[model samples]
Target: MNVWREDLLTRLSAAHSATEVFSVIEREGKALGFDHLAYGVRFRYPLSNPRIVLLNNYPEQWQTLYAERGYVKIDPIVMRGMVSQIPIVWSEHYSRASNTFWEEARQFGIAHGWSQSATDCRGLQSLVSFVRGAEYLGSAELTANGARLSFLAHAGHEYMCHQLARDHHAQDSGELTTREIEVLRWTAEGKTAGEISILMGISDRTVNFHAANAMAKLNCANKTATAVKAAILGLLD
Candidate 1:
């Protein structure tokens, strides 16, 4: 492996949690001439609503503002990455149609950024972005470093997905029983407790019992969320 690849693997091997992984990414981003980094993972399934996580070392005020204003819902970079795997370099024109999203980001010192995305076999999509203060990212720079930047995105994404897979396996082993999975799968298939009970040859009360147990174990808000979470984690597969 080259130096960047070797360094990334070494750091990821030492990372035990998402926070640690983000820290490693932050260091790597800085070394690659960035001051801030943002990483997000989106899990597939439940085509209507998927699970997502965002990690960043952005200013606290900006983080709060972004959430309160729901900037993510309209972020051009995020919207583009959802359908395209191409790397994006932020530009004024990119946000021209959006409602001052880029301007607001600049106010928070998040100007001049690049973003790239990658997807894994498990249907996990990862988008990694790096931002710096002043220097413009011209074409020549992109020609020279775009591949490395793309590699960085992939590296961080794959490492996080690996961690997620491990956590899911551990969670499945401890939290979800076979019966619970059966109930959840049926629930995901749009079956009510009554219908599931009839199909499974169990009492309605017993069906609800398993569903409730699964919900509690999965720490879900409702049966729907529990079913979706299980499917996204590949526990249903």
Candidate 2:
């Protein structure tokens, strides 16, 4: 194992906040010869709107343009990285890449890039990218950096998800009581409050009471979201 990589992983895993994690990653990316670093995590639930969390150090203009133009929908690295199990050296010259998007990105000083994605235990997918304005990556360069980049992608994803999970847990406001957890767990099984009441030998009003309390503690809008949030946070386990 590389000493630098061991130190990097230690620092990342020890990070106390998302900002600290990104700081370590940005500095490491620069040390690795890239001028910019980016990472994104796509949440696992809510199939209609799987939330995306993105962090990047790209130029401000590029960030604005990318968001306004919705370039994520056409980004080749993100597209392939989400499904690929290896580090991918992506370029603007790829056949299927959006020429307009790449042209705009280049004008803003984002050219050469490499990316890889990793999936967490909960099926969440996260990707890390290293980008620079110059120095195209040749086959030799790719070979030299492939393993390290893969390590960075996976290690970065792990700690990023760690910080994210911490944030989620923090937002829970308070711990769920035993009855509240049991109610939510049953609700997660697609059981209606009435059914859960019958199953638990409790009255319908008492079931609703527990579910409502769980929702409040979890900071969720309603019983369904409360149940799902509890399950995601492993509170139901």
Candidate 3:
């Protein structure tokens, strides 16, 4: 890797909080010639109600307008990220579905942009987008920086995932042991105590014991709820 990429990854890995991570991204993004930067993450475990986090240096009014209009739900770039890992350059031709959104983004001096996405083993999906007003991000530019941009997207996602998971665990008020997590993960797959015991090579009573402890730690009323809670908290990941 180049010095620029190595240094940026080092800084990102050392970042302990969301703000610190955002700062690292902003600095590195500007160094790469972007005028604005945005990073967004979404969790995929809950299936019922997923969690999303966004960090951006966009204009305040644009941010407010985007949120107020629920643009996240309809952003074509985001939709593409869900199914493919391809890097995308912003253009009205490809963003016909969200023409108005793209137009408004241009009004905020976001005329040229590119985005790439990364998904982790924990089912956390992250997208990094860089935008500028004057310079167009053409094929030549993408060819020059594509590898580094993809790396940034992945590393940033991993760092942010670790920080967010730590914070969420703290807020959950308890921690699960390795055995507890293992048992809960299997349980989430509809495994009963007997099945879990066979899979884990433990007694059924032991399986129940672990399940009971996990339920208590998670403050769940039953095993079903415990499994769901664990999945939602990304423990299954």
Candidate 4:
């Protein structure tokens, strides 16, 4: 990596707070030819209601307008990002479905930009968008910086997730033992205690014991939830 990119990643990894992290991203983004930066994370568990957090250096007036209009739900670039990892270049073509929204964004000086996304095993997804008002986002620019930009997105996501987890106390969480991990791993594969016991050469009672302990540590209500959470958190890996 070039010194510029390498130093940015290093600084991002060591940032002490959300503000500090975004500050670094903003400074580096400007150096890379962008005028504004935004990062957003969506926690997608609890299917009934997912939560989202957005941090940006967007103009306050534009931010208020966006929220008041409930634009996130109607933003096509954001919608496409939910299912695909491809970097999206903001343009009339991609935002055709949300033409009005696109025009509004342009009026606020959101003229040209591109976004990159990163998804974690825990079903938490994040997008990093670097935008500027002037110069078109040419293919040559994307061709040159795509990989580094992708890396920047993921590095930002990693630190944000870690910081958020730490800020929210785990409530005295304990590490799952090797046996507990084995049971949860199999449980995540949709195996019952009886099946797990036979496969691991243990009693069904022992399998249930491990699963229950894991559930307590993970604060899940049942074996299934425990397994799912553990696997998603990469405890199994």
Local accuracy by lDDT, each model: 0.83, 0.83, 0.81, 0.80
Model 3, position 223: C-alpha lDDT score: 92
Candidate 2 residue-wise lDDT at 173: 54
Candidate 2 residue 198 Cα shift, in angstroms, is: 4.1
Best by TM-score: 2
Task: State the TM-score for model 3.
Answer: 0.82
Per-residue CA lDDT of model 2 for 26-114, tens digit only, reads 88788779999998888755546886788888899999988898887888887887677677777643656777888888887788888
Clashes of each: 0, 0, 0, 0
Q: lDDT per residue, candidate 1, 1-237, as tens digits?
A: 398689788989899987788888888788778999998888674468776778888999999999999988888888888888989888734644465877778788888989988988788998899998679889998888888888778888988877765764464455678888999999999999999999999999999899888887767769998898888877888
Candidate 4 per-residue lDDT, tens place, 126-214, comes to 88899988899888998888777777777778887666555542552589999999998888888989999999999999999998899
TM for every model, in the order presented, reads 0.76, 0.90, 0.82, 0.75
TM-score of 2: 0.90
lDDT of 3 at 116: 83
lDDT of 3 by residue, 45-115 (tens): 44677778788899999999999999878888777877888887777335445679878888998778788
**Candidate numbers, best lDDT first, in rank order:** 1, 2, 3, 4
lDDT of 2: 0.83
Q: In candidate 1, how many Å is residue 60 off?
A: 2.6
